[model samples]
Target: MSGQLYLGLDLGGTKIAAGVVSGSGKLFSLVRVATPAHGVRSDLRALFDAAQATLAAARIGWPKVKAVGVGVPGAVDPRTETVWAPNLPGWKSVPLRRLLERALGRPVFIEADRNVQAMAEAWLGAGKGASDLIFLTVGTGIGAGIISSGRVVSGSRRVGGAAGWIAVTDRWQPAFARLGSLEAQAAGPTMVRAARLALRTQKRGVLARLARADRKLTGETLVRAARQGDARARRILAEAGEHLGRGVASMVALLNPELVIIGGGLAEAGDWLLAPLRRAAKKWGQPLASRQVRIMRTRLGADIGVLGAARCAMLEMEREKKSNVDFPSNQAG
Candidate 1:
């Protein structure tokens, strides 16, 4: 509290997590709350509540927080400070930065969640030593953050890092057209749907039994079942892994990243996902780039997103200090 303290908020689809982090990448207090499904209003309330709770838990005050950084699951226009989050209904063109500035009484920085995750990894996590890397999150949805020559790549529209739409297959399906080709085939929900479809034809596996018992299937359920020697579950994961690998291969060929760090919920499957992903990447990826790239799971675990947000805050604070610009407090939205 005496020195510079940064507030990091990860506004995920299902949960909003906030953490107070020091300038040296030390996390102080972390808090999480379920994301309200109602709309953007509820989501904003949940985010504010989580941030306030985290600050209180850390024994800090609003004035002490040098800057606040938020990572949202969607496109963010840093220039206009607007957000277009598909998962958050009614979030199209929302002025997230201005609203957070008013609510938190501090300057706020917003970026795509995956980009922040890549920043966190490059700064203090698995991709620490790598100057060029990609952080891919394969969970409820699929996305990628690209870093080249030690810089985050924000394309012309500031949406270049969104790799979920990367085409992994030539065949065009409705889901692919709507949700992005790679995400349509490899995201967590897609995996579950694939498993359900597979069970219809081949009903001989622990997956079928588990689906019958639970009455619903999830990526976690499929991963757990796969670990228990469920053939269908393993097959589904393998297929997803292959699709994911193809996507990674495309990224590598284009970006030539030194490392690729995979995170998010589905990553809990560990080697079950990595092994096949590695195989497919090597098979489909540009040989030179794929051979040079090192693919690994995230070392930061659940804290990656928040930590990434913290990194963004720290960077923003540094920029402000260098430019000698006083960050406005309680700005009007």
Candidate 2:
């Protein structure tokens, strides 16, 4: 549908966020609801409700809504309009486009969540002017969305930026098959595990003290402990950062992006995590590439995925229009 506002659905494991976005990258009428763990059927209901509430929040109706775009949490095949969203659980080769188009009565575009994040950042966030950039998210698991020459680098199989699979060590474990070496070693859960392990051997660390009665070590605990001048916690994060940097170095050498933007739950560690990452990237990256590229944290905050999904829909619409104009169906052969 051709309309003024675009509907962006950011589907995540825990929540579904719907936002009405203007063409100029202004987001409005954001509505959030819990994602249904039951199944895709229930999740679709939540998605539908979120969309309707978002439009009402912005005081807009469906007639004013443009095409819808969704950012899924796993592999996406734009051509087939199918998604394999692992985070959604039990979603395998789901025909998301057909379902959404039927439910919302609007054209739908789908992309991996990481790719959607890059789209938003490039459109209106940190990578505003850069033609080539890497958007890396280091949360539940590490993933990247790479853009080169103003185009997305979706691989032949649409898994081009699967950064979680980056190998940082020579030792290969079967577990790496699922979580990848870098992720298994440095991702949020792994970081917490490392902190807990540190607490077992060294009882003097602030981290052990910060974990409440349950002694649950979380990323927040690590951050708080590090903030309170806990060397053990800081050291653990820095080590992870260094490992992440090694991965970044490989990306830098291969992609030679102008900017490497980092975002996600773990990124909240700020300079403590990033400082080491920068060092490792520089040290391991090709000298020329490392000298020119700048690594920084994402500035888009929490709404990155939704904004990106909307921007992605806008871009898809533009491309479709161009394709139609170039090969008019009305033209006689």
Task: Judging by TM-score against the true structure, name the best candidate.
Answer: 1
Candidate 2 residues lying further than 4 Å off, grouped into runs, are 1-3, 34-39, 199-210, 213-217, 324-333
Please write out the lDDT profile of model 2 over residues 154-173, one tens digit for every residue: 77768778898899999988
Question: Residues 1-333, candidate 1, lDDT per residue (tens digit)?
Answer: 567889999988777899999877889999989888588889999999999999999998898988899989888875687999876678889999999999989989998888889889888888887778889998777888888877787776678777789888789898876679988888888888888888889887788778878888878789889899988888888889998998898899999988899998899888888999999999999989999899999999988889888888777667666774533110101
Candidate 1 regions off by >4 Å? 198-216, 324-333
What would the TM-scores of all predictions be?
0.91, 0.88
Model 2 TM-score (2 dp): 0.88
- Please name the candidate that would achieve the greatest lDDT relative to the true structure: 1
Instruction: Write down the worst ten-residue block by lDDT for model 1.
Output: 324-333
